[model samples]
Target: MYPPKSFDIGWPDLAYGLAACGRDGDADRWAATVERRFGDGGTKGPESAAGSGANGWEPAAGGGANGCLAALSVRSALDLALAAAALPRGSEVLMSAVTIPDMWRIVVGHGLVPVPVDVDAGTLLPAAAQWAAAATPRTRAVVVAHLFGTRAPLDSLAELAARRGWLLVEDCAQAYDGPDFRGSPGADVSLFSFGPIKTATALGGAVAVVRNPGLLATMRALHQEWPVQGPGDQARRIAKYTALALLTARPVYTGAVTAAGLLGRDHEGGLQERVGAFAGTDLMPAIRHRPGPALLALLDRRLRAADTVRAVARRAAVARRLVVRLPDPSMVYGADAPVHTFWLCAVPTPDPAATIARLRSAGFDAARPTSLGAVPAPPDHQQGARTAAHLVRHAVCLPLRPGMPDRVLDRMAAVLDPEDWGPAPGP
Candidate 1:
């Protein structure tokens, strides 16, 4: 029998995989260089532009010159949530049904009650009316995620939250520095993830943009109280972060689990469950005025480079034709949206299972939606389900990771052409 291939294409690009450790020497060098170049500009202290003072983020907080670090990922979001919910209990935290499990886990971890709202088709933005309808007397906050690097309509959501006197938490994990959404100032809190595969990855960290001072102070305290690695453990942690950034072939910590399943070495749900479980670790809780100065500098520089890469992918995505075509809403409403990971063309094929199976056999690794039933809301609110199912039936997420070879992209696209497959089988 032939041996399995060395590389596995899965969701979350391997280029940004967490499986490999960080590069110590390179990271050290980068750190020193960044310090020399950027100085204390974006560092997590009083000197930071993200407003390191007792007040809001300083202008020098190390994102773009116009940008400041914000807490928005799973790690630091806990701190943001705790601060937002200062009430004794019975607070209602409205969340979207289209988000990953991490968001729900954090909401439940806090003493707040989660009320999930449905999303619109195509773009998983929750209907402002749906949220308005779900609001009750105890509603304390509304948390919305910009899933798949697509920004959910936060303006309406934020306005609704404001009208009802509830805090609006914009989950900008996927929408990193893409563009400023309308009503950002209206939000009580906004968060961003700088994880390994995020739009702007510093390997592991997040920023929360707080419009309220009291909440910011409480969030800082909560971060300080959380568990931290001992001095002895810092070396190991830093080492891991370094390798993960530099290594190209390391088995991605996150993707390896799913990849193993795709390779048939593990039972179904093994990889998915493993991934969900590992999301609980606490990375950075406190907002360092200059969190990972080296990383901040790198992120600042990489954003431009990433935009260049994304531009090319966008052109390709626009040109490609799928075998089965599903209509997509053209033009993202948000001015600052990231280049999509997939252009998302769909087919109307009857047997998606067999189609996926065939693709897997032909050395391509395709995936089904992971957030299908993870939302806390009822079945009806999961409009992302219909969107995802529609996409999955005839669509495949081809490899679009940064630096992915164009030849591979073309080959994957070729497989999706309906002409390549025979007539659809009838029921």
Candidate 2:
């Protein structure tokens, strides 16, 4: 039972973890730097300043060439963006009805109302008309998340936001290294995640780019006041990352998967739960923690070796092969996007659990990305939102990683036959 996908940690991550155990000297130096810059509580620290093109930290194309802010995660970045935007309390923020649960929490936590907009069944993105229909007088902002590495229709959404005098925030958490990767030139702010499953896994971190200098200043101020992750927290992260790396190593992963199967467990799901169960006191939301030097070094190494262009090309090639072999190519989400990095080669079906079971039986790992049944929807958009929600429940994400073996793709395609997974046609 090979899991659908595993963490991208490798030798470098292991080395970093080993070094982190005795990195007291490096940690002390970082603490001194933090104290020197932020001790007074009035000046910004090196970590906060790193996003401002200082200390060799420059914004990437996906993040835009603007002042940037680093955060503990994408949720934190969104929190900072919402605060910096200074929308009136309880202002409406339009977002796709089908999105991560954490995103909804962050929006509501910021004293903002999340207005859910229905998404297109094919592309899994909200249409500009949908956005307009969802907008109310209280709508102050729109968050366009590029789901599954599909480039959202940013140009149209941007125009709509402009006409309504609404701020546009691009959620590029899944669309980095994509075509038009800057994520809507018209966006007031853009956010990118480097979490475990993202294109560039930094164990955990995120970047937010602000187009306006004033907003950047405001976010920087907020960052300076936010608490940093303590040494214990950092140590826990290192241990978790290392454990995942070892568990997912080729030699160990098969046995781990078998053990999970013996216990009647879902390999991927169980692994995610285990990895996320941290023991230390939880940091406050939106706290800006400086990644340790070792972690930063590992991230830099991963980025340099990523070769995103080649990786995207490989993903596109695999997607093309999958489309030709699958029973219904049109059911593949993001197939028609302007550019697709195929972060998740998702296909909408009528019964995802059954399909995944079939694929697993056929010796191919497959799973659903997330559950949308719990997401809230507005009355007016209920019909369309329900459609998207159903699509999410039945959407199967096939394994599509850079340099994946062709045999795995073939097995996945074979199991996708209508006879095995159910009828391909859907309303």
Candidate 3:
């Protein structure tokens, strides 16, 4: 079993807000800022790195995240992906199998196929040349997701997209701080998520940066026509996000800790129920786009805060111990990422069901993968389905957001010690 907190030992030292959702009750405030920032007549264009040429679009007509405020929400981003699919009904979209179910549902609901693809065993990227070969005429775009804090090899995908004249959609949800992927306008589009646990969790926000003015217009129109999310739904989301922030920030809070104490016996049952619920329904329809000023402020501060990166060994150690102690190790590190605050990708185990159980039993709160495909796959990439399936089957995303305490890290480590793996290793 891997030792807890060992991976996070070298995290860059920085103190920043860990509020995945908006801080306090700033959700509304953030939403307003987003609307103003990307409103109908915004002046700001998309942000571009130095080489993007001087044509960088001005910021939206209004004010928002110092520059990071999302113009949409998680759900809206999904819609934007579908819009870009340009797919015939039921056409397939290849995705890395190691993904969150929510993204899968979004693809299917949008009338696209969900093709799962495999990855490079070592780098956690699509196997060498696999993406190029997997393309099918029906494939419209290739969604290369830069998962966790790691940057995907966007250059490779960009090259492929150019040769094939296909769209390259960048899923920048988990890539909090990354190098800019902006090239010429039509080269590709980038989608960023600002959900809780994301680099800049602004309550609920997302953005799809497009170079094609026409495509951007289409996405913007879809967003404008989107049904207004109701109050109850909004309230529920707020509550859930708030609870998540609390649990993530102070999981040992009296209420949750006490509940675990009283209900640890049925922890497995609870996990099963949660998994079942997650499997049965799509949690997307409930979320909507609404950006405000407070969110923008928080995003700016958080991004600046992130300038101070620290080692997450303390958290990664806990995740590793749990991973090793689990019955399965085949998929322990499909993402092959180095140890950070936690084992950040999906993993292969005999039973995610049981492993989740053990983690909860040990007082660790883990979550499923983030998302799979909202963008379509390329025409030649038949392996997209395989990649996505592998991601689902083997990847294991761990929880290692900012601000976790040392004590909690120690407790987690104690539970996953190799000695606790049932047999001592030979010295």
Clashes of each: 38, 0, 82
Query: What lDDT is obtained when candidate 3 is compared to the true structure?
Result: 0.46
Off by over 4 Å in 1: 1-73, 177-183, 231-264, 267-353, 369-373, 378-396, 401-411, 417-427
lDDT of each: 0.45, 0.64, 0.46
Q: Estimate, for each residue in 106-177, the C-alpha lDDT of model 2 and write its tens digit.
A: 778788878777666566677667788777788999877777878855888888888888888888888876
Itemize residue pairs with steric clashes in candidate 2.
Answer: none
Tell me the deviation in Å of residue 113 in model 1: 1.7
* Tens digit of per-residue lDDT, candidate 3, span 1-427: 1211111111121112222222333444444344343332122324222211232111223343332225445555666657654667866665654445566667777787766555554455565476766667777666555554545455666777778766666665655342233222333566665554454344445655665666665765665555543334334444544444344334334355457558655432343343221234445554444443334434433332322233333334545555554444434443354312232644444345555557656655554453343234445443334444444543434444344456654555454434323211111
What TM-score do all the candidates reach, one by one?
A: 0.62, 0.82, 0.62
Q: Which scores higher on TM-score, 1 or 2?
A: 2
Query: Which lDDT tens digits does candidate 1 get at residues 220-288?
Result: 555445443223332343355444333223244335535666787752244334323134455233321
Q: Which of candidates 1 and 3 reaches a greater lDDT?
A: 3
